[model samples]
Target: MKKQILTTPDGESYPILTGTGLLETCGQEIAALTAPCRAMIVSDSNVAPLYLEKVVNSLKLAGFEVHTHVVSPGENSKSIAVFGALLESFAEAHLTRTDIAVALGGGVIGDLTGFAAGCYLRGIRFVQIPTTLLSAVDASVGGKTAINLQHGKNLAGMFHQPAAVYCDINTLKSLTPHELADGAAEAIKTGILGDPELFAIYETGDPENDAEEIISRAVAYKSKIVTEDPQEHGVRKLLNLGHTAAHAIELLSNFAISHGHAVAIGTAIVTRAAVKRGIMKNDEGTRIINTLKRNHLPTDSAFTAKELSKIATLDKKAAAKDITVIIPETIGRCRMEKIPISALEGLFADGLGEQV
Candidate 1:
């Protein structure tokens, strides 16, 4: 397995290993996290069927008592109702804190399960086996777990770190073109946050063909930031490059647009906005736009400027006096500029690709 040890914000180190056919190793891998006891895996409907049995078989073969709970897949399933059902499943089986919660799906499943584990018994252990590329590269490693609320995506959540995370690249073979595009947008965002050379790699590399190397780089990039600041206090803030506007688009669409695609559009907007703000160069912004388009993600969407502005006001990155904005100076370097709400109008206009 390809391995990297990441130290999250609270100074905790966890392993994120990537490779083909690594799902079978979940037993020996997670056995080191804790004792080989009862591990309750929370998964989604679609993905669980494809690989859940294999994971359970591996654990059971390795002498672990494994319990599995499968819920309907998609962001729509990330709700309080699902959490209640998951907890109910755990309670019915008489699981305890001594046991573990293993999340085995995409971002939705990982976040939902991780949040449940965070609250269960005042914080038990969790091992993330992220199936989707988006989860593998970003969602799984960060420890930012949350289910969506009526108001927004990831608005309801907690800072719950998992015991460890496993990224099985083989599972990604099932992705459709749209799904793969979502993951590519995130990889591009990582570049927008902190690596021009890495960003350049995507410029020439074909997402249709270079899935393995691209996923690895994205995972490695996220690990570097998450290891330093697990919490979004400083360096972690850079990771939010497209997230600010992306979350708005997700909410405005009622989540019709996939998270990664919204993020790709969000990235394009911010890159354009920064250029208009005179901080980011024109060439760099063009690179970001072309990248998004090349990946088959949206470069622009039709959310009114008024609605987006209001959503931005409620973002986690926004506070009483200022809001933190992630702007790329080049490819690998993104810095946070805390600016007043009043100063945002011009940039917003520019971000919409509307010239002053």
Candidate 2:
């Protein structure tokens, strides 16, 4: 297993392990961290049948009192109702602050479970066992845990770091091509923010063959950023590179479009506008769009500029009358630009290649 350590500014730290067959030894790893206390494995309907038993058995073998809570899989599960149900499950399980909650699925499972773990008993420890590529490279590392509100996505959440993260690349083999592509969007976004070599991997390398390396690099990059600004008060905002417009697209689609696809569209929009405005070179913009397309990700959305700006202004990143957007100056560099809410529509127009 390839391992990376993420240390926060406050000195709290966790290990992120990525490799094949890590799931089988998950219990042992958790045991090493704590005294084999009670562990609640929170999964989704889709993943429970596939890997829940393995994790449960592993935790049991490691002397942990294991319990399981499975929920329906989807973005819909990331709601207040589901979060309340999960907290109730924690209470019912009698999980103490010392005990850990294990998230055993994709980003939704990780986010919901992490948020629940953070809220239960004033906060208990949690472990992330990400099953999808997107969660492995993105959600599993960041301490940001949130549930979507009726108003927008991730409007309700907190910074609750996990005790450990086990990303078994083997689980990714069970994913469909579309699901795999879903993750590529985040990986590409990471490359855009920083790491030119990682960006090149998507441009010319075989992602499937380089899964371990890709996860390792992406985790390392995010780990560095999170460590620098654990609370997202500073440089950490760079991580929101494509997420501003992406969230708007998701809300507009009523979540018919997946997060990664929305990110692909959002990244393309931002890069297109950056190029047109001379913030980024035309060649770099073309490379980004082409890379997303190469991975079967979308570069455009059906939502009009006016429609996107309306929803985007309501984003959590909005402060007073300004919203901070991460604009790419080049392939491996990005900067935060705070634009007035009124200008957001024109920015979207520029990105959409429409006259503003």
Candidate 3:
């Protein structure tokens, strides 16, 4: 198994174990941690039948008293109601702070379970067994846990780091093409943020055969940023590169669009806006759009600027008068620009690569 240790800005550290067939070793890994005698496996309905039993058996063999909770799959499942229910499950199971929570699915499960762990008894240790490429490369390592609201995406969230993360490449085999594409969008985003070499791979490499290396590189990139700024108080905000507009796009569509698709469109819009402002060249914008298109991601939205602007105000990244918008300086670099909230509508209109 390949291992990477993530160190927080405060010097705290956790290990990310990446390799094929690491699910069977989850129990042993947990035992190597603080050794909680009790654990709760939080998974989604789509993943429960496939690998939940294997994880449970592994935990049991390692002498852990295990309880399980399976949530319905999809973005909708990451809700306050679901989060509340998971807390209730923890209470009913008599989980104490010493007990741990194991998130055994994709990005949704990791976010929901991590939020549950953070709030359960004011906070408890949680492990991330990210089954999706997106979670492994981005969401699982950040300590940013969130649930969506009716008004916008990730309106309610907290920063609670996991005790450990086990990225079992074996899980990728079961994912649908859409799932893989969804994750590739994030990896591409990481490449665009830094590491031009990584960006080159996304443009020309076969992701299926190179999943492990690509995921590891992305994780390492994010880990370095998180180490420098664990919170979004500074450099970390750059990680929101395509997310500002992406959240608005997701909300305006009532989440009919998946996050990866939304991000693709968001990045394209931001790139175009940068081009219009002469911040990024026209060729750079074309490269970003082509990359997204080549990856089977979307670069267009049907919503008008007025509709998306209203949703943008509710984004967690937005402040009372300004929203921190991330723009690409070039394909492999980006910068944060705090735009006045009043100008958001215009930015959205301009970002569409058309006249308002």
Number of the top TM-score candidate = 2
Tell me the TM-score of each prediction against the true structure: 0.95, 0.99, 0.97
Q: How accurate is candidate 1 locally (lDDT)?
A: 0.81
Q: Using alpha carbons, what is the TM-score of model 1?
A: 0.95
Instruction: Give the better candidate number (1 or 2) by lDDT.
Output: 2
In the predicted model 2, the residue pairs found to clash are none
Q: What's the candidate order when arranged by decreasing TM-score?
A: 2, 3, 1
Clashing pairs in 3: none
Distance from true location, Cα of 87 in model 1, Å: 1.6
Per-prediction RMSD in angstroms? 1.7, 0.7, 1.2
Error of 3 at 273 (Å): 1.3
lDDT of 2 by residue, 185-273 (tens): 99999999999999999999999889999999999999999999999988899988888889999999999999999999999999999
User: Which lDDT values do the candidates have, in the order given?
Assistant: 0.81, 0.93, 0.87
Cα misplacement distance, residue 354 of candidate 1 (Å): 3.3
Error (Å) of candidate 2 at residue 203 is 0.3
Which one wins on lDDT?
Answer: 2
Q: Which of 2 and 3 is the better model by TM-score?
A: 2
lDDT of 1 by residue, 194-313 (tens): 666557767866565655676677878888877777777788888888787888888888888999998998888888888887888888778888878877889886985566767877
